[model samples]
Target: MAAGLEARGRTATQVRLRRRFLRFVRVRPGERVLEVGCGTGVVVRDLVGLVGRRGEVVGVDASRLMLGKARTLCRESARRTRLTLRVADGARLPFAAGRFDAALAITVILHVIDPMLVVREMARVTRPGGRVGLQDQDFGVVAVTHPERELTDRILHGVAAHIYPEPHSGRRLPGLLRAAGLEGVRLQTDVFQDTTLEPWTKTFLERRGERAVRFGIVDAATARRWLDGFTHLVAQGAFVLTINYYGAVGTKSR
Candidate 1:
């Protein structure tokens, strides 16, 4: 996993988002759940708790670094016994058919090159009538609080295009789920609107900004420019960054 992603594992928003996403999942005790792209086991820890002693939570990620981190976290959890972590790819899950009651891929579908394959894989692993849930943010729906909307959009798109070649995957999730032969697909959106930019600015500058530098994605100059623009927007007191995250759940055919 990228160092930036490791850093993201420790962010407050990331933690909160993971918890909220789990709540959205409504995992019950004694149920088997697979969490795709379970980076750093942040969500996996929550899943373990939700599943209780009788249930099991299997977490899979393609990144060895992330799996290492997840293993460390899992080891520290008291509920570790109920959790399992694997280094696997979402596009090709290494599980037998109908192995899980439900599956969730939080903020991971966007990274997949062939999202349909992932959807099919998740459906294949889940039992009939089982639910498969996917959650991701749409860049087009993201509300920027920065003063320079144009610049922010430009930077965001530029970086996203480079980091994630297919940034449009999130937009196609609903259709992909339908195409995967899942039924009763339902899509819902959640918005996190904050008037103060301090949290987000700090999140970006401290974590994302540093990651950009570490990964050589953006130079110090560009990072500084982005931060400066964000600071100015925060000072204006009219800053409100609204994140539009959508979640869709479908049941495999019986």
Candidate 2:
């Protein structure tokens, strides 16, 4: 999981989208920021650079193992900026109210049991007029090319629905911020596109294929055939996959 996070973070388009979200949230030098569910510290590493030497970035996740990996991964970058890692749940952040200039959860809301609770916690930790940001991929918007369109749709949609309570979580981000009592909400939409079957995308599809079989969405032989379809597309230089990522920011009322 850590390796996959690192790989996705290194992808060219991903880096751009992450930085763009930070900019949208107005993460400036010297501002204190918090990242909820900071898995592998990928976004935290980027936050450190954006916040600069005077600023600090605090990352919190529920998984101790993930935090351990994050610590090791962020060691070098920590020298340039203040970085803190804590084992804490997103729905119940371990911080004082009005502590941060901004709080963000990227690609995290979809997995939570109660996304609104998490967003409300994020708003509570941020100071009045500070920004709360969220970014997530809407599985409903995903598009992938394959000769077996029906099979691809069944696997992709079925796996996502089984894994996430809200497969279309991305589109609800803005409304979440508003419902959390944040004002002046704004949204930014971005896409993750893969045409050559990059390593990260390959792993993504492989995981889906595995889950499809496990969840009884498809049989073993069918899953194998479905995955092989992607390989063939890649070989033919006709592979295409795109997932929409929605980023939203809102200000805490003063």
The candidate scoring highest on TM-score is 2
- Weakest 10 consecutive residues, lDDT, candidate 2? 13-22
- Please give the clash total of every predicted structure, in order: 0, 0
TM-score, per-candidate, Cα-based:
0.85, 0.98
Off by over 4 Å in 2: none
Model 2's alpha-carbon lDDT is 0.94
For candidate 2, list the clashing residue pairs, or say none: none
Could you list the CA RMSD of all candidates, in the order they appear? 3.1, 0.9
| Per-residue alpha-carbon lDDT of candidate 2 for residues 1-254, written as tens digits (9 for 90 to 100) | 88999999999888888988888888999999999999999999989988999999999999999999999999998999888999999999889999999999998999898999999999999999999999999999999999999999999999999999888999999999999999999999999899999998999999999999999999999999999999999999999999999999999999
Model 1 C-alpha lDDT per residue in residues 96-183, reported as the tens digit of each score: 9999999999878877787888889999999999889898877666667666667566566655666664565656677888999999
Clashing pairs in 1: none
